[model samples]
Target: MSITSFSFPTSIRFGAGARKQVAAHLLEQGLKRPLIVTDRALGALPVLAEFRSHLGGLDVAVFAGVFGNPTCSQVMDGAAAYKAHGADCIIGFGGGAALDVAKVVGVAATHEGDILEYVWDHPQVRAISNPLPYFVALPTTSGTGSEVGRSSVVSENDTHLKRVVFSPKILARMVFADPELTLGLPPAVTAATGMDALTHNVESYLSPAYHPLCDGIALEGTRIAAAALHTAVTEPGNLQARSDMMMASMMGAIAFQKDLGAVHSAAHALGAVCDLHHGLTNALMIDTVMAWNYEAVPAKFDELAHVCKVAGGGAAFVPWLKTLKASVGITGTLASHGVKPEHIPRMVEIAVKDICHQTNPRPCTAADFERLFQAAM
Candidate 1:
């Protein structure tokens, strides 16, 4: 495949008190009524109520029905909410799922068919011709980096598989990287999400695609995650650690514009087949996947080792990752997370079709995916 142009378009406001800037930014854009798309749990939080107080003058409607993995129906519902409130803009106010729903809702509200019809590589999917509403993302967690991403992963209702919708039109116009908002996350969430960010950086760096910009960004992002993830998880109130993790997450997303690798493919399958959290699945499977992929790019693994401050290179990197996962309180194999022997065949099938693995340094076949699943198990 021929390499092409690249773009980093999101305007970022990175610091404490950045969430407080949302109202002024919206006003500057002439956006009056904004629909807040977030998960049910976050919507019920007192923090959400408090955040709404910042947009007192603007008419804002909250659609908190989005849950675990965003489904096609939820995206449609979010579109309905956007229409019902006459929203002029969208504010993605929580984690990856909420942000993904918000992005797709913008398209679904103005488009003519089911949201699934726009999925990347779908048989009946259509081009995204309609312009999405103005969008702003405020991620409450330091993972997924969906805040700056141009693609949204939505789970298909029929297949229970995750499908990506990639469109430049859905990219957030503004991103508020406020560490204060992530302070309330528990240790488990912090660990899982941090691992997700790290996986993005690692997998992208190992991908064979030729994008120097992504390569550099992935290296730095990995370094930042290595240094900050443990602290962020253990001491959630540490703003500096939180800030570093958030930066790593955003940088990971930016780097992954080139594409991801087998880790993401396996993780996507896990999310689809077992209904697992996207980040958690990635966290659990990355080391196993890397072990299988190490020989394909031993030099890259050495570089990764040096960047992450691990003592050894290549195969030793896997143990370092395991140590990091344990230190951050993320434990459990795929089987422990609900993957069964019966699920392996279907998981491999889904993984073999995942687009992320196309860029993997090593070619991954269905048999390789089966072995990876078994290793994780």
Candidate 2:
């Protein structure tokens, strides 16, 4: 086995009204000019306004260029905004897309060449040796857990192929995880994003990695998500449910430092090829892939079943996922979500090439990916 490293070092202030501390914290650090990186829709919402109201003393500029799946172009645009406003720090606001883009905007602003040149797999990937502007995160959605992530996933503007810029340098300096920020999420968005958090916990736990610490976090994260996801979706105003889901989301992100599996590979492929929401793709593909994975790690599945309170142990785990999906109103296949049969081959190619599946308990081939997509459809 290869040597592994573990870290969970992000400073997090988790509770209701945590967002109110952002301005004072930044001010104490002497950061007066801050750029707010968020999605256009969220920028127009009362949430953004309320958050800004807390920063009355700071000079803040808004860059609401992020939308849908994040793209390299969006990062470039945000960098331009950062430069234009002479912003000394970044405040990431909104869900995963906005936060992912926010993570890399500082990289582009400080480095030469296009942001894509900094992707980890680039032939001449740029080193991030310069100090990045101080960045803090406030997530308005309890999914992806991008607030605590050390990497950013951005796609090519024209190709829609995803690329990753993986570096500890991009990790937010602080995270204000206020569940109150998520109170206005619609039930459908809540369901899909909650499933994403669950998938991260589930896939990381099932990964064939030798990180016991991550495995413990993943199992507990799975338990938290399983207990709160449905209630979070149905009762959007339930602060306790929102808080649990938020914690589960961050825990999933933290645990996945050990790595992920086929579900993430497949979800990344769907995000790239079908332009589907990452969470929805995960929700659609998780059970299908897990069904195929069950035989490889029955003991792990049994543990998962115990955590989720599924009866009949390992054999019941996949069925429990299916039931959970339906209960959350995520009822349908990939085809129903607008993924076409013709999309399978391209998605398979992408999934096979993704780094995430290398750690899957059950090894996946191109053929296996094709079958998973078809079965998911």
Candidate 3:
């Protein structure tokens, strides 16, 4: 149930006009027809219009039926369109939802049966056709680096639960992380999504893995998020800050391959039940989870404290986090997101099932999830 090998995508282009070169990249991948998967907002925007214009007379199909947190049904629908239209590739052109949907569609279009059947430790089905068409990830808001990463988190509405489909090959044949396109993200979304990136780095850094490379990547990613997240929130037009945040977001995904801890375990569960913003949910429980882990990994926190100028121990970390949270305007409790205490039991059960819990520094049982949920409350 564990992997000792690591592999990443070979094609990723990052810069100012990376997305604008989609046509060229698509051609390079030998994609005759591409399904551009995006959300309603981006699908309706002038950016999409520009893509259409650029792809004039080309065999291009657009499927924008994406929910905030992607569901298996959504991916199924998208897969149908992809099959019907003979899409030779998938262009994930929005935030995590779009990217996640595109990843699932690519898998479902070729694989048989329900998506959840592919969960790790018990992959009901396995193997994908070599050169399984093309998947080009063009991240706009840059929270969940579904671009270069190898897993997709899709919500199963029947259970109000999130499931992970893991594989490095899920990464796009190419990735486009352009900051210019993200200049339009609202301040609130900027704050929430940026915090999501911070959570990824923190969780990955704390994961009890032997990968020094991931550890280094996670720490640097945290530093980048800490330094740039607030500025990106307050000033959307700050290209420099936006660019840094975007890179930080990508770094979070890259690092987390080593491991993730309780924050992710909690947030993944909370996200399904409350349907809260993933990043914001993580932010709500981050400090709390860190405090819980203080005893298990004090040296890790101490290192993070020094990296983030947190100073001292548990006492210093909380206040420093509060200051940063306020700076990004992310200071809200779970109740603010309409969570009810009565729902804690079921929530804990789902959180315990998430694969992210497996890599957590400390084992989190159902009781642990309930306790963490209570703390976030």
Candidate 4:
């Protein structure tokens, strides 16, 4: 067997009022100036104001320029804000896009050249040798679990293709996972992001990687998500349901360290080509890709079905997912979401090139991706 290393080193404070602890945590560490990196829409919300109220003695600046999908420009722009504010720490306080940009803001602030040059695939990837800002994450949404992630996915400005900056150095030093922060999410956003969390667990478990640890975490995460996603969407005020989904989301993020599968490859492709929300793309394509993937890993499917309590085991798992999506208000296909048949070719090309599918239980050829996109449509 080949040598493999594993690490799960994030400090987390999980509860209803966990966001209140961020100020104290930073003060104890002697970080007085914090730049809160968030999306424009979230910045305008009362939740951010409430969070700010907790940081009474600290100097805080908001960088609310992150919007839509995260991009290289956003990371660089955030770095500029960091320097302008003379921020000594970073407070990532939104959904995936904002948190992802926040993760790398320190990299851009302290390093040379474009932030894209630090992506794992860059030919001469820059080293993250400098000490990064003290970073903490408070997730307002449970979908991407960017609060706990070690990598950031940013898109190119012109091409809009996604690029990944993978490194342990950029990982949040701490995570304040407060489910109350998610209580006000719109039903649609909750549903899409919930599905995104579920997809992460499902795809990570299905990946043919050799990490049994991730497999276990993925299975448990699937069970939690299956039980709580609909309630979390329908009754947004139910803190218990929200909390379960949040924990499940973090578990999915942790589990995917084993890597993901073709579903993510397809989702990334859709995000790049169609500019669809990442989670929504995953929700749209999950059943289609899983139906195709079932034959390759029947036992894993059985395990998933068992964890999710599907009556007919592996054969019923895909149907269960379809039902779950419908229950959470994630209806319609790729075409219904404005994807055309003409978009399939470009999405397929991008999917085949995405690294996530390399560990898929079944290998995906360009032809396979073409079929998947066509079927999803």
All candidates' TM-scores? 0.96, 0.98, 0.93, 0.97
Q: At residue 140, what lDDT does model 2 achieve?
A: 93
Off by over 4 Å in 2: 1-7
lDDT of 4 at 85: 98
Error of 2 at 136 (Å): 0.4
- Candidate 4, residue 18: the lDDT equals 84
Number of clashes in every candidate structure? Answer: 0, 0, 0, 0
**Local distance difference test, per candidate?**
0.90, 0.94, 0.80, 0.92
Which residue segments of model 4 deviate by more than 4 Å? 1-7
Which digits, one per residue and each the tens of the lDDT, describe model 1 over residues 176-242? 8788899999999999899999999999899888999899999999999999999999988898899
Predicted candidate 4 versus true structure: per-residue lDDT over 130-216, tens digit per residue: 999999998999899888899999999999999999999999998888899999999999999999999999999998889999988
Question: What TM-score does prediction 2 earn?
Answer: 0.98
Q: Specify the highest-lDDT model's number.
A: 2
Instruction: Give the higher-TM-score candidate: 1 or 3.
Output: 1
Lowest summed-lDDT stretch of 10 residues in model 4?
Answer: 1-10
**Count of backbone collisions within predicted model 2:** 0
